[model samples]
Target chain A: MSSADLRAISQLDEASRKDIAQWVENEMAQAKLRSTIHNFTEICFRKCVTSIGTQTLAKTEELCLQNCLNRFLDTNSAIVKLIQEQNK
Target chain B: MAFFGKDSEASSTQTQDVKQRVMQEAAQELAVADVTELINNMTKVCYDLCFPNPGPILTSADSKCTEQCSKKFMAAWNIISQTYASRLRQ
Candidate 1:
């Protein structure tokens, strides 16, 4: 990651600095979401689609992709829940 | 008093300038990062789908295959994004 222009940020008033910090946090959140989705697509594509000759995705392939995504998300939440329970 | 007045006015303008610069830079950085990720994934997925039999040149068939592969990859990406967003809300 590029080092943020800290000198410029330091010139802002407290309120303005707070606003900038909030905005940057939101932007980072969105970027994180995008990267996660990209990763999921790569994994699900490998799992769901075995053939590639056709220009269009077969209906079965589409369904497989969706199921792959659903299962992945399910696993994610289940693991998070398990971790929380373990901590408790 | 003179120095304080001048310094406050000058610093306020500088603050405004800096705020705009920081916000613009942040947005630009995020956009570049996102686009780079998309391009990288597209390259990898399309290469895999279209280059199973490697050739020196990309034939018309290979080009078509790559195009379709990219489209399918994008479609999958959208589906995953939607599913993940909904999962997060839950």
Candidate 2:
């Protein structure tokens, strides 16, 4: 590492180092959220929207999009549960 | 000779300054990434939904469809984001 890198790390107190680490962890979680939201939006949009000319979502389409998120989460958990069961 | 160029107190203050700057930079980057992602997704979803066919002229219907498509896409994005966030909390 360069002198600057060494100096930077050395400068941080334990608490400051922990705070920086926590901030980075939080940012990573946020980045994951952004990725998931983008993906889910596309997936649900395709599933829910058929005719796209309406100014407002039809009642059925709105419900489908809402349910899509729940089902997506449910499916994810179910898959994880299945994997855990298989591993055991 | 100490490896650290600065004394303890000075180093702590310097570290705080750096930490603040780093966080601000990260937040700015996150904001930019969010807006870029939104625009890209909006363009893709709206184009597919609104302009299913190619036409030389942009009709009123096409613009209206694109507007609604943008709104619905945003709504879906928010709903999914919230749902994922809630699930993460559990």
Candidate 3:
């Protein structure tokens, strides 16, 4: 039988066994999340920095950039929250 | 590396039997695309910030200024990301 068949059977006939499968899937999902955060940070850093020297980020620039990142996340969360809030 | 088991039979069992394991791969792909979109948005703003004057539109073998500008812009983006995330965590 195909693997799908095995999975279907496992879900229905072998409930206890399915617990292991669920845990593995969640771990994979978490790994994906970690990588995503890393990738975004890497590129965002590249676009923001202008000068070649190791000078510290200026206060105004730092605040603005920080705002940029937070606002982006906020926008995403707000959109979803608003959608659900409105729909429900 | 973790997936590779003692034998072929064991490895297949790890890969095929676990439905949850697939979620990691899906999450990775989604994150990659999300990051790309973020970079694109940030760059547009940076380009405008750096090059207020409508200079040459950046060809591959272009002027030195264009190269320098691109580098600095990326640096700003990085700073913003680090500063922003750290501040939020605080």
Interface RMSD of each: 6.1, 4.9, 9.5
Ranking by DockQ: 2, 1, 3
Tens digits of per-residue lDDT for model 1 on A1-88? 2334565465446677678778878988888988888888889988887767776778888888889988987898899999999999
lDDT by residue (tens digit), candidate 1, B17-73: 877877887788789988899989889878877788799887999888888888887
What is the lDDT, from 0 to 100, of the residue B62 in candidate 3? 36
lDDT of each: 0.77, 0.77, 0.53
List A-chain TM-scores for all predictions.
0.82, 0.72, 0.48
Listed in order, the DockQ scores are 0.41, 0.42, 0.16
Stretches of candidate 1 exceeding 4 Å from the true structure: A1-4, A81-88, B1-13
lDDT of 3 by residue, B1-90 (tens): 222222223244454544344444545665676667655654564455445676556654334444555555555556655665575587
Candidate 2 deviant stretches above 4 angstroms: A1-10, A85-88, B1-10, B85-90
- Among residues 3 or more apart in sequence or in different chains, the pairs in candidate 2 whose N, CA or C atoms overlap within 3 Å are none
Model 1, position A74, has a per-residue lDDT of 81
TM-score of each: 0.82, 0.77, 0.38
TM-score of chain A of 3: 0.48
Tens digits of per-residue lDDT for model 3 on A1-88?
2455344334332343455456557766765654555455544444444433333555665565666667667787899999999999
Error of 1 at B44 (Å): 1.2
